[model samples]
Target: MVEATPELTSTSDSPALAVSVLQMLRTATSVQHKALEARLPLTHADLDRSLYTRIIEAYYGFHVPLQRHIDQFVSPQACDPKRYKVAALIKDLRALGLSDGQIDRLPLCCDLPRLQTQGHLLGIMYVIEGATLGGQVLRRIIADRLGIEADSGGEFLDVYGRDTGRRWKAFLKQLADFDQPEYNGDVVDAACATFASFERWLDRAGVLL
Candidate 1:
């Protein structure tokens, strides 16, 4: 298990030893994270191409509107220009044999987590950016089991590829700025909400095995 080190950066309002925002967020959200991961269909023992396609299709339905929701709150500079996640999903879908029209016809997730404040936005982004990092492992698993690679049909799995670790560290660095005392609740709550929203969306999409 990769452990997060909590560095204290306290305001006058905060206790002297309060955990760093990233570590706090991680401890708060770990249960939801593991629960969601458990329910994902990616690791099914009987995994095959058709199941993989449906999984990617389900992801497209969720990721499209989810990224749009994030976009509604993100400043231009806040979003990494290289993080063309929706575009990567499109590429994977195309490589998996879906025409653009079929992709357009896929049902989208509507009930999303609320992004009401900077804390909320940060919380939601924490989940997303962390998932992008986790996808590096998933990418390799898909390649081994399904014979799919980034060039073929699994581009979204490791969207950042070799830069995944660097991108994740960059994201973690930005958390330092939001280490104020008051925003912790908002951040943690939004992360939990994001996970709940995603699980509900996945349930409706019927992609989990």
Candidate 2:
């Protein structure tokens, strides 16, 4: 775990913490972000259902355990458990023909980092919530290229639907409210670790090009 520096504890305001943490980790997170995007097999001229299924399966492998861990530490009022992506992933997986048994047996991601503080929890939520924003774009691409609709195998990507932006801003407000000084380092460290762990998990699942 990376140590929180004195500088990180400088803010108690939501907007300041939000700005500071993002500025601190922007470069690190961006690298991991671009790497994941580059590895997705969406550009092929002959993308198939099997390939798309594999992609969702890999996501399932990472998110199930990841979200479970996040939920454990996240405040009940911070995020609605009902809106988490794991359920959508399960529905989409089943829609793609994976049985309940098969879904249960899907390979789990290894070496996921643990959250030790509210800041750490929010950091991980930052990554997950941020993905929903990009998912809107990915959902459109999947629909155009793979013909999967929000009610079908693409539901996971269609998270928040028309309210994606609103949900994201709400999350930011929640994050801002977590402006305690003690958690500064944990927040930034967890966010960076999340991006790295996600990249590693995706690589392990063979989803990267």
Candidate 3:
């Protein structure tokens, strides 16, 4: 692994970038939810179950990835070359003023087994990996600005990047190629909105402070 000195890029005026990334994350999640929603037979019981799944999946999808990022930041010696993405994410969270406590709790909100069973695991991974990639870029910015190695505070970023890359890529490809008979854009829109809501929550909590 190459230990490059920290190089900070300018993210002072990059709210739009955050919005774009968050939007992508949200839309993909909604696609999975909408698919499940359509599958529920229309009976009251089935409707209830479907609704439950949609709500649960949506909530879990939104928080887990962010939680993973928080977990990665506090640990040292965990960052491998691949975890550059993770480092970048910590930068974003720090920029947002997210406290260690809030960041740490994000994982508990996610359901690991159900995430895989519902086929939304990929979507969740997409959100996490995307943030991680963004984080790497952000870390460079931090390093450049601070005149230190980009991953000075967080090392796990490199570790996660290599480990999650292949699986994340496969998931995205699967999503892009997914050919379902029924197409629902509204669900995608809903997910985007959901993510936006969560982002706002972090902002309000002074995670960016």
Candidate 4:
């Protein structure tokens, strides 16, 4: 087994450390993007949305009903694409080594309820802003690593990232103002767990140093 180095394990509340993680993810994404570009047989190819749509269906279809209760807090326009179902995304999630239970509760962590109204709105905002693009970047990373061409996979990243990104950032400003430290910590922790799983699988696949 490839062991994760201490550098990878280190964590702090320091913005530096958080920025480092984000930067590392960005580097990984760039590498994967280059890999896909090199392997794709064609340039200017649109990503296959049909396959992308299935990936959506797999993940969100099951979670949609559960998330409906949480949706009332967010604007209809804001939450619309957030509701897209992606089946391949969920399958790829398994390839990233998330446990079934962890994957199952994943939506709840994003669409938090049973908290205050601001908390609920914060959860939606946090997820829509912070989580969705991260999720797409990850899918792009996987598709690229697997040598899936633009004709087959690029649309998943392009469409999902571009569309959901605007709302995500809009909600992020809203999320930063919410004062519930405990809930904020929970949200951060969930993000950490998900990313750690991604890193772990990448390490296992020998894609990370």
* Best-matching candidate per TM-score: 1
Note each model's CA RMSD in angstroms.
3.3, 5.8, 18.1, 11.5
Query: 118-147, model 2: which lDDT tens digit per residue?
Result: 788877888888888778887888899888
CA lDDT, candidate 1, residue 76: 70
**Per-residue C-alpha lDDT of model 3 across residues 61-147, encoded as one tens digit per residue:** 345564454445435454234423444444434434456565555433232212211123333344445445444553354345433
Model 4 lDDT-worst window of ten: 1-10
Stretches of candidate 4 above 4 Å error?
1-58, 72-116, 145-159, 163-166, 180-209
Q: If scored against the real structure, what TM-score would every candidate get?
A: 0.89, 0.83, 0.38, 0.37
lDDT, candidate 1, 1-209, per-residue tens: 22444455678997777677788887777777777777886876788888888888888888899888877788777877687588888999999999999999999989989888998888887888888877888888899998999989999898888888998888777777877878878888888898898888888878764
**Considering every candidate listed, which one attains the maximal lDDT?**
1
- Between candidates 1 and 3, which one is better according to TM-score? 1
Candidate 3 structure lDDT: 0.39
The per-residue C-alpha lDDT of model 3 at residue 200 equals: 46
Tens-digit lDDT string for candidate 4 (1-209): 11222333334754433323323323333433344334332232443434333333333433444356445556667755644434434554454445567557553223223423555444333433444564565556547555653344343343345567676656555555554545554444433333443333333333232
> Model 1 residue 145 lDDT?
91
Computed on alpha carbons, the lDDT of every model, listed in order, comes to: 0.82, 0.78, 0.39, 0.42
Error of 3 at 36 (Å): 28
Q: Give me the displacement of residue 162 in model 2, in angstroms.
A: 1.1
